[model samples]
Target: MKLKTLASALIVSGIMSQTVAAAELEISVQNLTHGNQFTPILIAAHDGDSHLFQAGEMATPALQKMAEGGDIADLAAAVTGAGGVTSENPAGGLLFPGAHVDSIMLDTLTMTHLSVTAMLLPTNDAFVGLDAWEIPTEAGTYTLNLNAYDAGTEANDEIINGGGAAGTPGIPAAPGMDGGANGTGVMDGSSNDKVHIHPGVLGDTDPNGGASDLDSRIHRWLNPVARITVVVK
Candidate 1:
């Protein structure tokens, strides 16, 4: 009887440990850009089928809102409505270049996948995105590098005109305060009207009056603009 009881207790303990490990997560993000800033980030944990935004697909209205502007309310609502768990704006505001937000606690509770999104400041409809990544069942730390994505809902004119509203024609804001004004616009060369890898910014040397309001030397960036760390505890 003693042996049987001990075996049962060990099994129960193992099950409890697995449950705890599956439900808790600690996440961190770093902006690995030269001069860009990330808007309020939205992190979500959901089932396998859900996605914040998929490449080669059209952008949803909620996603377009977040990409054009810095808004995440509609996207948060949609995630929660679909039975997903989310943590919004963990950094509390704009995540500047080389800045890192650490130890964001998220109780994922039965969710198996993770997704994160945030708009890149000083760019039109450009956002850093992580589509449904499978959460590891093993208890350990994992790191991921994310790329900038174009929502393809608006033109990349690179004009800073406070046009944050969806379907607007210009960039919402330049948090770095380095953007210029009073110039022509860069034409949207790509005909792809779907979410795709951003071709980076077409910033020019002129800060006062050029084809773009963004500065080529100050606002340019390569791929893998952000790095994410996940700890499954």
Candidate 2:
């Protein structure tokens, strides 16, 4: 009878521990750029072993597809397949500059880290990224500043052509429609083949014919293009 009682107590303890391990999080992402818009954002609560994109490393094909085309399907599938929780396109569509998407709820059962990603329009293979941030066990509000990363898969030609496919040589659709036209490409090749910090866009003054389609004064942005707030509950 004592053994039976001890076994039952152990089972109850295990269940209670499992419940304590789970966490609910309220996530909010804000676009801090002046002109650039973010494509559908992908937020993932995953284990420490998983990462959306790593600096100084070659980008995965899934990451390349997202950084180039603003497509998060592949990345979402990967996160879900790894037993992770994902919130895809929380903003419902393109997140314009100075806009914020709030109250995104994610139930992280066993995941220990968080990651975020989204393509920045009007640039070539540049995307906002947050890689493998440790989720604190203590409940509190945490803020993070995200930066723009160059996938290094394509050159920053600064063209406004609709070339979103991987290995393409131009920028995809510009949501603001503020981009110029009839501009020559910025560069023929990329200087780095691995993922790294973006050098930012190089726009010209001429709208009709210049070295780039982007406007240097309007489209250019410094680091920390996005801000993420996580509320641990």
Candidate 3:
């Protein structure tokens, strides 16, 4: 499918989860960016038909809560309600630059696909994610690189004013402590309001009064923001 069309079709594509044999999974996640921070990670072994957030589709209220405020309560509930297995917040808190978590393990029942998500802090609605990755039956370590995605539920206002609630217009935070303050917003808002690949952050050098409150030297990141390793046992 074409990329643009896929965005709008995300809701219907792969909407069914295929069940897999019961297997134990050992998962590890690494933040590859130099300046970004990941909120509590939500890892799941789920049927292939369901998703935390589907690209090219509107963000669910549960997903909006996670993407906007770093809260996973509703999404987790939805996943659990769908009979998916979950591992919540293995990092315990924000996973900062170069940080990693290797202690997560899951014993799958009917779950076959793996989905992972976490809000990328200091942005309005940016997140690093893995959407419905199939778990290999053979037991060996598998590596995957994840991308930064926009929930497309909010504008990229680039202001740091602690507005994390869904539909709020500013970034909840800049955990790096190197971000600037009292600056004007960079972009007005996104044209696309569905889930889609993120246009990376556009921070400027002027901290006190730049177009963005984020520092260009510290807050910018390219694609493939995270590296994930999965071990099937």
For TM-score, candidate 1 versus 3, the one ahead is 1
Candidate 3, residues 1-233, lDDT tens digits: the string is 69978876775544433335687998899999989999999998888898887889889988888999999888888889999999999999999999999958888787888999999988989999899988898989999999999999888888998999998889898888887888878765668989999998888998898789988888889889999999988
Note each model's CA RMSD in angstroms: 5.3, 3.6, 9.0
TM-score of 3: 0.90
For each candidate in turn, the TM-score is 0.91, 0.91, 0.90
Error of 1 at 76 (Å): 0.6
lDDT of 2: 0.93
User: Looking at candidate 2, what is the lDDT of residue 129?
Assistant: 98
Error of 2 at 103 (Å): 0.2
**What would the per-residue lDDT of candidate 2 be over residues 4-95, giving only the tens digit for each residue?**
99999999999877754878999999999999999999999998899999999999999999999999999999999999999999999999
Best by lDDT: 1
Cα deviation of 136, candidate 2, in Å: 0.7
Give the least accurate 10-residue stretch of model 3, judged by summed lDDT.
Answer: 11-20
- lDDT (Cα, tens digit) per residue for candidate 1, span 1-233: 99999999999999877753556899999999999999999999998899999999999999999999989999999999999999999999999999999999999987889999999999999999999998988889999999999999998998999999998889988999999898599987899889999999989999889899999999989999999999988
Between which residue pairs do clashes occur in model 2?
none
| Backbone clashes in model 1, listed as residue pairs | none
